[model samples]
Each structure stands twice: as C-alpha cells, then as structure tokens.
Target: MASYGNDKEDYLKRLRRIEGQVRGLQKMIDDDKYCIDILTQVSAVTRALQSFSLGLLDEHLAGCVVDAAAKGGPEADAKVREASEAIARLVRS
Candidate 1:
C-alpha cells in the first residue's frame, strides 16, 4: 500500500490477470499439454511476477524510502532496511 498508494486498483488488476494466467497454466497441465508449452507459460509467469515486483520496488524507493531518508531517524532507517531486505528477497526469487 505504501508503494502503490493510490494505484492499488491498478496493481490488483494486474495481479488478477496473473492469477488468470496461473489458472490457465493449471488447466493446460490437467489437459496434458505439451511440456514445452507448459514451460513457456511458466517462464511468462516468472517474468510477469518479476515485472510486478520491480514496479513495487520503484514506487517504494521513490516514495517511502525517499521520505524516510529525508526525515533521518530510527524509523527512517528501519524503513530503508525493510525495503532493502524485501528487494534482496525479490531478486533471489
């Protein structure tokens, strides 16, 4: 919410689309689709998730992190640390 702010609706819409994609992938597997086709869809999903994470990270850096740094306090430091850790985890995924 901090990163997305007023654009919550847009983010949710994107997530819904990704959910549909995942459901489609499940259906394809259930239908015994080709292995390559399933792998292709899985790749697409991975990319989509990465894109989503990047967008959130951008917003967080631009808004929350920037505000925190400007304030310069324990709370600010904590926010920055949290953001860094979240980004690291995202990259690992």
Candidate 2:
C-alpha cells in the first residue's frame, strides 16, 4: 500500500548495495585503513543514502501526494503536510 510498493524490489536492491558499502566501511576500519581513504568512502556512502532518500521522496510526491490532491479534501491537506514534514526532515539531515 506504500507509494514505493511498485519499485520495492529496486529499492531493496539499492538498500542492499548500501548495506554492502557499510560492511566495506567496517572492513576498512578493521584493517586500519588510511584516515582519508576511509573518510572518502564514508562520504560516498552518505551521498548514496541521500540520493536514495530523494528518489523515494520524489516517488511519494508523484504517487501519494498527487492521488490525494486529486481527491480534494482533508486527506489531501494532510498528505501535503506530511510530505512537507518529510522534506523538512530530509533538508535538516
């Protein structure tokens, strides 16, 4: 029932990739890798997650927000507010 349901598999694949990157980070730490190198990889992982979050947010706006807006009522307002809050959170992060 979620907006990302249609692309759930793709999302999962991305999450798995991110998970792998995290494991890689752990390995880098355990191996006592160079500080700069590890920091670079950490930046890469952060960017990946940010990109993923943005994609999901776009899908939510396109699917859920649009659908609710079309119906024109309190639900639509709530959806818009929910989406605004989500955006704010993303921005803060």
Candidate 3:
C-alpha cells in the first residue's frame, strides 16, 4: 500500500507494462538486437521506474509525511528521517 489507495490501480498497470518491456528486452537480446538499441530500451525502463518511484514518494510526502509533521512528535521526526533516507537511496541509484 505504498501507493495511495485510489492510485494503486494506476501503479499496477504501469508496473505491468514495465514488466512487459523487460520481457521484450530479454527477447531482443535473444534475437541479437543491436547493442545500442538494447541500451536505449534499458534506459527507457530505468526512466519509467524512476518516474514511478518519484510519484509514490510525492504521494507519501503529501499524505503520510505531512500528517506526521502535523502531529509534531517522535513520529514526525521518524517520518522526515525515513523520507530523507529514501531520497538518498534514490539519488545514489
């Protein structure tokens, strides 16, 4: 449930499409696709995943993080730390 409940279906569909793209990549490799062409597809998949992650992060910030901050206690601090860690991980990737 990392995704907002109402947005879950959209995320699922996006994931499924990315899954198909990955399978397509494998097939292309099996078929001896050009190296640059394969690399291009890989880039596309990476961008798609990053976009999806950012969307989920936005939702978390707008919902869970905001709510925790509003409460102004240990939970709020934890939420901020959690978000910072997540951003750091993404940046490293």
Q: Show the colliding residue pairs in model 2.
A: none
Query: What lDDT does the true structure give each of the candidates?
Result: 0.91, 0.98, 0.94
What is the C-alpha local distance difference test score of candidate 3? Answer: 0.94
RMSD of 2: 0.7
Give stretches of model 2 more than 4 Å off: none
Tens-digit lDDT track for model 2 on 1-93? 899998999999999999999999999999999999999999999999999999999999999999999998999999999999999999999
Ranking by TM-score: 2, 3, 1
Top-TM-score structure, candidate number: 2
lDDT of 1 by residue, 7-29 (tens): 89989998999999999999999
Task: Please say which candidate is ahead in lDDT: 1 or 2.
Answer: 2
Compared with the true structure, model 2 gives a TM-score of 0.97
Per lDDT, what order, best first?
2, 3, 1
Candidate 2, residue 34: Cα displacement in angstroms equals: 0.7
Clashes of 2: 0
